[model samples]
Target chain A: MNSIHDMGGMHGFGRVEREVNEPVFHAPWEGRVMALYRALGFLQFWTIDGGRAAIESLPPQTYLTASYYARWLMGLERSLARSGIVGADEIAAGRSLRPARSHPHIMTASDVANLQRGNFERPTASPARFKPGERVRTLNLNPETHTRLPRYARDKEGLVEAVHGCHVFPDTAAIGAGENPQWLYTVVFTGRQLWGADADPTLSVSIEAFEPYLAPV
Target chain B: MGDDHKHDHEHPDHSQLGEMQARVRALESILTEKGYVDRSTLDLIVDTYETKVGPRNGARIVARSWTDPEFKARLLSDATAAANSLGFPNPVGAHLIAVENTPQTHNLVVCTLCSCYPWEVLGLPPVWYKSAPYRSRAVIEPRAVLAEFGVELPENTRIRVWDSTAETRFLVLPMRPPGTEGWSEQRLADLVTRDSMIGAGLVRGP
Candidate 1:
């Protein structure tokens, strides 16, 4: 249990607190690469116009397949070709491809960072905070947007026996919400605490939690 | 490396994406039918990572620390081994250091590096966690960031920021929320939020 909570407290590369005005940290080519990838991928998690604009803004590159989205598409095309299934080129040649059918590009590390950093904006403050040792309940539902609680962790309860300092809310960042939420918490729960017969009586699983996902039990 | 995803058609119809998804879906369906990828197993993977992994892991650890002092000491000393005892796997040689989120101080997490996370316990990290701004800015201006999320800390509370990297990770032992006295562990897991585990949020009131 301690180990799991400790996992949440992960911090390395801790020394560089603020970005320096160094060229190495960010380069113009980096932005161009991002734009090229976005164009090739047809970015998702964004509106259609936004996606179009991103693609149009891309810097020139000789090959589309080299870009992130194009690479993924290349995989799909191969799968279709191998399966002896319907082909994308036929549809494209016919000019009958639907916008809704397009899959958004799988965001790369750099692209994910760029999108979250520039576009997202957060609210002024947190709506609530649980105190140390207070009781709380985690929500069971799943929202496609960003959330900290995984499906396996749901409906399991633990004591908010300890509080870690605040960090950015993952949900906000996931949906271009920018940084949100301040504190992350560790709740103590036993194995029998979650699965009765399936779990070892003496064994347990500790979970790291965020505030918004939890409610008083 | 490959360019087969595109269709080389005789006419300029331009309906490539629709055909692409349909083809992909068809392949997925075939794989599921052929038993290459078990549907239930994939669903379970998605389910476990999305839910069962986060705050519950944190809570159990905190309980152990509060109840068993020796185990707590061992956990503090060598986190990976301590976690492995509970059937957790550590691939990154992740050395964990647990920070007790107490009334006076709160411990938080961010990856100043790539989105290094404790997947053994927390499962795959949420998409937001892997972002650059969250990784880069989390350590520098934690207070303002917290405020934006609706969590405003008392100025006196000491803020301990954890930087997640490939070599090490951190988890928060959230201070319990108030209300019920005798709720079972299963009941408690209900309140453990992914945010709480990272030190961004406290369990909300029911």
Candidate 2:
């Protein structure tokens, strides 16, 4: 999905606004929204990729206008309705009208205390196709489903700086497909290659490209 | 157009803020009623990010790297393991990669696709980090972005922009400022600002 969310190199946006002494959460509800997002992870209703995809699926207007957490709130609603955990009508009415669905896991205070990040690395029998210092070109892919390949890096040539081993492929993991693990690499592209000859000579861009997104140049 | 300054905040409109509050409240109540999430757990999650986990964790890591050569090597070699050794684990399905700033090169981190940050170490990302301007221009015009953040590197210094497009997260290890040779690790940690670690600003000399 080449949505507004894939904003890397597109212009017309103004200068970056830096807030002084910014609070973690602007409002109490902001904190609550974040908490809900974290807590719902225990349910395993959606993958992290799926959650991101939901946010990306937002209308371009809504995606551009909504705040960060507000986007999360909207994405949460979208996921909840899609998963049948909650319905749009129930959300609009501010109450639960349907019978509560049972989840295998419900986050408790104890679960919160012992929370740790999920590890995505998996064992693979196949060797990596590309090695460090190898020249590769990113595939020009424009999939409608969730994809980690940003529009800016599509069809760009880069050098593999490091091999990140086998990890869950987001393109599959995002859309309820299995975690088709792929070898990830740190591909470095010159600013001139990504943008144009007018780009700064002193600048370079590196992205983590899954093996599927790359081919030997 | 006149209300451009309002773009500084995530939620600028009062009505929109109120609507978000109500929507979040409604969602929370529904989830609780459905027995999917407990209120106490939600409270604990918020408290953890608010009080415990944050840039202080990353700051300690940076300060340790500055003081301890062996630890710095480990951080540069295997950042995920080094972060976990300091009790700052990477977020779900993510790896931590610490890029060092030197006399000739600088590193900046961004997720142009989404706001994929190392939450365990840095906590939630700031609003500007997830903003469109920073996301769109950070990779293409990093020197300009750095200038906005008051970080003007020498013209000869190379800028390496890490767009965290996968499960990898980047932390910029700013060069230790001079004139603080004998400073305590704690004192050095005090100089590690979030912006410096994000490569948007330089660690100021005391």
TM-score of each: 0.40, 0.96
Tell me the chain A TM-score of model 2. 0.97
Residues A1-217 of candidate 2 have per-residue lDDT tens digits of 9898999998888889889999999988889988998888778899989999999999998888777888898999999899999999999889999988767868887777667667778898699999999999999999998999999999999999999889999999989998999999999999999999999999999999999999999
Query: What lDDT tens digits, residue by residue, belong to model 1 across residues A33-52?
Result: 22332332333334322232
Deviation in Å, model 1, residue A168 alpha carbon: 29
DockQ values of all predictions: 0.03, 0.67
**Candidate 1 segments whose C-alpha is farther than 4 A from its true place:** A1-217, B1-55, B63-71, B87-94, B178-187, B204-206
TM-score of chain A of each: 0.43, 0.97
Cα error, residue B12 of model 2, in Å, equals 3.2
Instruction: List the global CA lDDT of all models.
Output: 0.47, 0.88
Query: What DockQ does predicted model 1 obtain?
Result: 0.03
